[model samples]
Target chain A: MAERILVLAEQLEGQLTDVTLELIGVARRLAAPRGSTVDALVLGEGVSALAATVPADRTLLMEHPALRLFNPEAAQRALEAVARETSPWLVLVPNTSLGMDVAAAVATRLGWPLVAYCQAIEERDGQLVATSQLFGGKILADCPVGTDHAVISVLAGAFSSEAAAPEPPARIERLAPPAELDGLRVRAVGLERPEAADVDITRAEKIVAVGRGIESKENLELAEELAEGLGAVVAASRPLVDAGWLPRSRQVGKSGLKVKPRLYLALGISGAPEHLEGMRDAELIIAVNTDPKAPIFDVAHYGVVADLFEVAEALQERLGG
Target chain B: MTLAVILKQVPDVVEELAIDPSGTDLDRDSVSYVVNEFDEHALEEALLLREATGEDVVVVGVDTTGELDQALYTALAKGAQRAVKLVGDVEGSWLSTRALAGLLAPVIRELSPRLVLTGVQAPDDLDGQLAPTLGALLDWPHTGVVVGTELADGLVRVRKELWGGIMLDLELATPAVLGIQAARATPRYVPVGRVRQAMRESTIEEVEVETPVESAPKLSRLRAPEAAGRAEMLTGSPSDVVERILEILRARGLY
Candidate 1:
């Protein structure tokens, strides 16, 4: 039998996530060089439609009503079982919040070396080598996992979803969750979306994005006014969205939205590499930061070293009502 | 209940980092290190637990740069009941997650803490793998990207951040590790006077830990990110800056 590369496909609300396909895409690349075939392991009720779309050589589906909502302990149990059955060369999972929670446990249960948040994978001298960023992308490390079985959770957006090509519907197989999941301790109560994002900033010609420097939720109106004056949409970095000051769709970053606006105006943003990756393509970049040395200034075409509130008001006044 | 908070010191991102001449690691002579932002939140979470339930919080760190003693002292000043520094072969934080996990599992078992907390991810190692690896090594459950948490009836109710505005409310049993993203509130600040007092009164306990041989990722090169664009620095009055912005926007036919 050909060595197999197993991918743990993630799904939500009965639909597959983009990161799942990205994982498959990475698995395909890693497997192609080894003469290995890729397979997908999906767990959720009524998920056949979603699993069928996996472009792997085989799709292993474990459907159960209890899995409609993700429970890490239960999923880990299922994945542990799947690993034992296939004894795959490597298991690839997306590095999302849920994936991170389960992948570690599965690797531990099976006693396999695991690498998390990998950015690139290359086969070197019959060994699987994965590269991942450390220290907030300041350093990249190349990890070599010996030919022995290993599990890897890949960073989201590190591989392009476009790289995933659809193949003939994969061969389907049914698996079973462990008979006893008593060892599993964590249980997910529910999924909550506090606010629905209403704006799509990807198509915006101009975007005004704010970061933690904005200070308070009330101050978001200042960004809104500036965005309004510039005929731009209002967006934010991850912190603002995490704090619920803005909806998820308005978040512009690796885990949020990747935007290529014509003009990008940043306020109080420190320009973390992840946030910069999403907006570096703007034709005209403007930044307002209180600190003159903020990293955001490096990419801004025009920079203001002053309070964002003061800058927003002055610009709003200059543009008139 | 005892809780272990793992603290890591990262190079202050505010300062410019340069690659060493060898191009294999960060230029250490010019770098100043500070507590990682999220680790502060983890410390704050432990302190909050101390405040609420009077749990003993033990702050643990691998002494990498010989600077961990001062960090542990700061943690003592902030409310950690005990501080420990693992005193050998930290290798400037180059140890792989597996190595670190191997080292911590023994310490955690000796401490017998009900919970272990670490920053969701370190600024340098944005991988967020340490906590989970520690959990796996200990054969305990672990969760990451946790923003808020509560303890009730010997269970941890955590609010985990999922992608795209989704939040998962999970109940994890005791002896679990949490990769804390933030505390329930901002980390409490300690005055210089208190830290100085701690320096005089507290001694960081040293524990020698031996890690098994392990393979770490190879860093072939290190370099600064290329500038995507250059900014025209704007100075002067706020009105001047605003007017300059307007003129440029108008020239570009934007507004």
Candidate 2:
């Protein structure tokens, strides 16, 4: 039998996350050499609608009323059942919060080797090796999973989703979760969605980010004004985000979004490596800070050493927005 | 209710780490160590739980090196009643999940902590394997990156931070392992007096490093990333600078 790679595709209210497609892209890379096939396992209420989107040879759908939202127990049981039946060579998942939980639970249950936050993976010496960042993006560690069945969670945006060619005929299979998990004990009561204002900036282009030098919440308006003038979005440093001045989505750092945008402008931002990891892939990076030695300058394509407010006002006047 | 907080000493986040010429391990000489930041939140959560319930709290450092004394002392300053360091040689040891599970199984059996808390991921390796590995060994319930937690009727109710800060509330049975996220709580600073007191009383026990069930994976190469060129200083009158930036962006296809 040809080797098989399983993708635990995550979705919300029936809509597949972008990370799923990204995983498919990664799976394509891993499966191409071995002539292996990629299978996407989706679990949720009304998840059959996503069958058309997944780029897999087969799409396994487990739809139940209890799974309308993410029921960890049910989801795990379903994925585990599929793994038991398929015996895939590797299991791929996104490194999103839910993906991380499912991957951890599944890996633990099966005693399988797991590599998280994987940016890249490739086959070597008949084993799969993954590249991951360590020491908060200061070091890169390449780890190889020795087991025949390895599980990995790939970071979002780590690999670009390639357009499928000569699209394969996707087949959908319905699965019933295991029944012995009755006493799992965890119950979900409610779900709360973040306000619309708190959107993830990693997906955004033309970002105007503020750092600690912004002084106060009142000064945040200046950055916002510049953002508005540029028709851009607003983001913040870890300190501002931790202080709740901005939503977690707008926080750019190692712990936050890993973004690649068309234009990223840093205003009064002292660049920390953690913050830069989230935005280092920006096509054009412009930093404005009074300190000449600010670390942000190291990655910036353009640097301006000046007062942020004055610089903002000058740019606003020039743009005349 | 007795609480146990697990801490790990890891490499500092800011250092530029290099791999040894051997291509198999990190160059330890160039790195400095610090308590994993998320683990600090785990310690804080334990302290808060103790304060709320008036329960005794013990901090345990799973130290693979004698150097973890500094981290253990820091935990003591943060209000831990006692600190125990599990000393062993973890270097060049793949420290596979099976081995870790085996080692912690005995400790959990002996400690019998009502709840065990650890960081979601350590900064040095960022493998995020410990909590799940330990949970499997003890056959306990496990939750990762929990933002809100409550203890009631021997059950642990937690609000997990899902993608984009979406909240998923769950109720788990006691004797569970929680891998806490850094955003869960504000870590408390250790006091000077407490540090001095902890240094005097803390006892560390060295244990043999468990042999990994699987051998260390081979590394083909290790190299530092090439440094990018210095940024171009776009200096001119304000309008001219803007025009210059626009030109650069356009040429670079950023526009």
Candidate 3:
């Protein structure tokens, strides 16, 4: 039998996160060439119905009270148990905030080559190669998994899932929880979500997102006026929210809402991978950064390599109609 | 009770980073090094946690950079109780996350801290693996992307962030490892005078260890991303650029 390719199916609040679906999508592509099976490991309390929805060759479901909430220890133990039994040739995990807690532990416990922040994984001339980001997207390294077995944590939004829905798993097996879960050290106490925002950036037609380049809270006025002139909502990157200059509702990134407005006018934001993940799909992007090599230019439709304040001021003067 | 915080020095990216002649690493001679930003957050979180719990704060680091004493002295100056540097054979080499974890696991076991705190990610840590790998090697509970932490009755409570601004509260028993994303407050800036005083008054404990075997993907080559950009560059003065941008918006019906 060919070795299986395993994907750790992540879930929250009874729904499979988008990254988990994306991981399964990548695993299928990797498995077809080797005649290997794609197996998805779904772990959570009341995850049986959720496990059945995984689009893989087989879905291994492990449900326990301790597994209901996200417990890094229990999840790692479950994944280790499954990988030990299946002896998978490759494992795919999402490199999101939740999945990072489990991915490295799997590699450490199984003694496999780990490719984190993986953008793509493929077999090239009989060797597995992963293209991953480094230094927040300044460099890309083509890493060869020298070992036969490897663990990859895929970056969210790297693989588009617009393809027709994959077939649901043909087989679903319920597995017993690992004995170690009974006496685990980590326990989930609660989940808290921010109250609904007054403005949903995701629904906006146009957005003016500010980054560190906006400089200070007082300078946010530049972005606000430009956004108002263009009938766009004002959004921000994580640093502005972290600094308390903007509310969490206005933040965009891996830890904030993803938006795809028609026009994304980015100011002073050197695009980090996290910030790019949220708004890369905007219909048209115009970025102004003093550094020509800022990663934002890679995604922008129009690039201005000058002071953002200067550009914003000029644009503001022209927009006064 | 003791709280262990690990620190490291990374090349400052604000300064230009040139690829070394060898092609496998950066040119170390020209780059300036600073303490990893997230590790500074981890140290600050430990200091805050200690304020309520009154546990000992011991900062540890593997001296990869030759100038480790400056970072250690600054840590001591900013309220750390003891500073330990793992020295000797492991200097000047980039240890893979797995190897770094193996090298530090035994030393951390000796301290037997109630909590081990480190940064969630470093520029080189590809998806931030050190804290989790260390936790697994030590067989302790681990969590990352932690924003806030509070010491509760028998367990430490942490606010672990999920996607889209959602937060979860997790409790872990003693002897846990956490990768701190940010401390409740900004990292305290150590005065140069305090750092100088600490250098004269404080001594860093040093231990010698061999290089642990590294298990990592063979990095084939480093290259800039294929500029898949369709961005039309607007040159000339800011007014000219802004005028062109307005023309683009009008063309796209965005104005």
- Among these predictions, the greatest DockQ belongs to 3
Better of 2 and 3 by lDDT: 3
The CAPRI quality class of candidate 1 comes to acceptable
Clashing residue pairs in candidate 3 (N, C-alpha, C atoms within 3 angstroms): none
Per-residue lDDT over A52-121 for candidate 2, one digit per residue giving the tens place of the 0 to 100 score: 6677888887777667777665666677788988999889887766776667668778867777777778
Cα deviation in Å at residue B19, candidate 3?
2.2
Residue B178 in model 3: lDDT: 94
Task: Arrange candidates, best TM-score first.
Answer: 3, 1, 2
* Candidate 3 Cα deviation (angstroms), residue B134: 0.5
Cα error, residue A181 of model 2, in Å, equals 3.5
Candidate 2 segments whose C-alpha is farther than 4 A from its true place? A64-66, A123-128, A145-147, A163-166, A198-206, A211-234, A253-262, A267-283, A287-321, B91-102, B201-220, B225-255
Instruction: Sort every candidate by lDDT, greatest first.
Output: 3, 1, 2
Clashing pairs in 2: none
Query: Which of the two candidates, 1 or 2, achieves a greater DockQ against the reference?
Result: 1
Best by TM-score: 3
Candidate lDDT scores, in order, read 0.79, 0.72, 0.85
Best by the lDDT measure:
3
